[model samples]
Target: EDKVVQSPLSLVVHEGDTVTLNCSYEVTNFRSLLWYKQEKKAPTFLFMLTSSGIEKKSGRLSSILDKKELSSILNITATQTGDSAIYLCAVAAQGGSEKLVFGKGTKLTVNP
Candidate 1:
């Protein structure tokens, strides 16, 4: 089985604040790392990171992958109430079909 852990399982922050979410994984045959934000419906894809690239950025959100530490972190700047959601970290294996193993996730609540 895959081992994935997320720190600070929950967080509460005010608007304009910054939050850092962490995820560490020890999955055999790891192929890539992925981040997702779940608000209500389905989870929305945020970023996908592979061994070749260690960092990804999209507007006020950025993520980094550390191969040496086998972990990844997501940073959200200028948080807003709309940003409140469950942030999930998943890892895909390198087999024929990608099987994603996900962590419990960190629930972020951005207050006004």
Candidate 2:
């Protein structure tokens, strides 16, 4: 199960101030999360967060950089579990605007 939560759904701010609105979640089969910033016309994509790692997976849906091919994939893996934790994303969009979407999946298979 996976869910995205935006704390303090509402807030008040002043000019020349720095604020951090938080979005937290707990996912069993966590894969990817996208952040959107909407002003008026349809919302635009801000960024994508995957359980895999930024954009560094390769081979089996892993992200890797090929200096020769001059290309890369966002499905690579090489990390530590202790260094694992969901990234907290926050954005300030128009009132009653913006949303947090949840997604999951990858090329990881665990077998005995």
* Number of the predicted model whose TM-score against the real structure is largest: 1
**Model 1 over residues 1-112: C-alpha lDDT tens digits?**
7888998899999999999999999988888899999999899999999964457999999999888889999999999899999999999887677689999999999999
- Cα-based lDDT for every prediction: 0.92, 0.35
Q: Which candidate number maximizes lDDT?
A: 1
86 Cα displacement, candidate 2 (Å): 21
Model 2, runs deviating above 4 Å: 51-112
Q: How much does candidate 1 score in TM-score? A: 0.94
lDDT by residue (1-112, candidate 2, tens digit) is 3355554343333333323334555544334455443333444554554433345322322232232322223321333222122223322223343444432211122221
> All predictions: root-mean-square deviation over Cα?
1.3, 17.4
Looking at model 2, residue 56 earns an lDDT score of: 39
Off by over 4 Å in 1: none
